[model samples]
Target: MTLLDNLLFSLSTTLPILLWLAGGHALKRTNRLSDAFIHDANRLVFTWCLPTLLFLNTARSSIVDSWQGDLIGYAAIFTLASIIVLWLITPLFTTDRSRRGVFVQGAYRGNMGIIGLAMVVNAFGTEVIPLASLYLAFITLIYNLAAIVVLQAGQTRLSPLKLVSQLFRNPLIIGVLLGLLWSITGWDLPGLANSTLQGLADLTLPVALICVGASLQFQSLRNNRYLVMIASGFKLIVIPVLAVGIAYLLGFRAEALGILFLMMASPTAAASFVMARAMTPWGELAAEIIVVTTFFSLLTTTLGLFMLRSLGWV
Candidate 1:
């Protein structure tokens, strides 16, 4: 298939899920569902469904021959570069120590776990699965470090070592580590084991998207509109432009270029709120950015695919 055809197919596949999320928001607005219901859905998806999906997707892939160290290096450098940019820009936007962490987190982090991996898998193939796994690992590391620094920026009592320890205990990080070890060791799952994992993994995306829809509060957007827009702009526009330029300068081509663009273009991660809630006082702001950016990302991602194709990078 041509790049435009592939882009259309991918967009079609993604649209239904986006619509489902929008419908959930509509339902919540009409008071058809309670906040508690949305909260529980978010909990179920994050703590159970998403991790299962990540683990099964990573574990089932043939990683012995497919693990690309160079791709991992590119992803790592891209993540670090983005974090540095965020650090420089964060102070300009917020002086509230409590709010700085969320602002910076939303600015720098992309939804690599959900949207990023899905796009890579859709645009490239299972062969890119190891690359996605490696990307997730590096992204997680950078995000955690950035989160800690941002959260503790003005606090004399905060210890970086303590923050690092807390991050290591995060469920998503644990899932990634387990998946990586299983991938590197080439461990085979029996049929039953694989089936159970695949079943759980399959539920992750749809459930997570639905939960995202249900949890979105339009009211919060009204309060933090400027921050949300700025963060989203950085995520969908500036980050991808920088990443693509850097990827080209560094000699990445084809699928690697496509993957890098997709990663950089993804909406803010669903976990950003969780991290903000746990580590900062601006959890509500983080959620607002996630909801707003997710809505806007449909257009940006489509345009990104078209541009990449026209430029013959994909």
Candidate 2:
């Protein structure tokens, strides 16, 4: 396909997410949806809907077909490199030590579970769910742990038991583990049960996008404007370019390369806000990062995919 074709397709594929986000934002402005409702909706989606979606997709995907250890390892390398680089550069960027973790996590830890998967499914197909799931499982863990360490830097002491307990309580982690275990069993749920779960899983993406839109507080970015811009730039631009280089060096191509790109290029996750709020006082910065990364992702991802497709890489 031509470059324009790729751009159009990319935009079309991603428009729904943007629209849902806008709708949510509009609803919030009009006061049609109360803050309490938005909060509850976010909680519901994170705790139940997202988990169901992850478990359903992972359990159903074929492990043998999707196994790509090299791809997984390479992606891990990208994630770690991002974390370390951001952490090292923290001092140069900001003086607010607590918000430093928010910036670092914002730069590297992408919305792989939501935006990444959606983009991959648009570009490739459902055949890649298992591979994506594996990548998601690995990075989600890394992101969570790294965020905690950075957020806790020179502040409250981190207890090993608390870390373990938090990991256990994290719904996403539990969903990934259960999904992998169920995939191992290879036992299909009865039709009625399966369909019921599928129905629940189907609600994840749209609801997530809307909640993200609703959660956004534009005024939050005002206090930390420059910081938000720098962090969002890293997430949307620098990181994706670096990821492309790594994928090429690792000889990833076609859907593998594309998924890797999504892994890198996708927006800052809404979950970042959740984690920031729970772990630090930097929730405002985290929310702004989400706003900037997600809105700009529309353009960056479109151009990124177009370039990749033009070269026959995705």
What is each predicted model's overall lDDT from 0 to 1?
0.72, 0.77
Which candidate ranks first by TM-score, i.e. highest?
Answer: 2
lDDT of 1 by residue, 1-314 (tens): 46566557556645665687788677877899886876676666656666676566566656656567776777777777777777677778766556766877787787887778888888888777776766676566567557656766634355767867866776666666677678778778789988877887777666566655766667777877878888888888888898888778888889978888888888887667655654555667887787777767777887888788888878
lDDT of 2 by residue, 201-314 (tens): 777766666766776677766878999999989999999898887778768888888888887898888777766765676766777787778778878988888888877777
| Candidate 1 residue spans exceeding 4 A from truth | 1-7, 144-157, 277-281
Residue 112 Cα positional deviation in candidate 2, in Å, after optimal superposition: 2.6
> How many residue pairs clash (N, CA or C atoms closer than 3 angstroms) in each of the candidate models, in the order given?
1, 0
> In candidate 1, where is summed lDDT lowest over 10 consecutive residues?
151-160
Evaluate model 2: give its TM-score.
0.87
- Candidate closest to the true structure, highest lDDT: 2
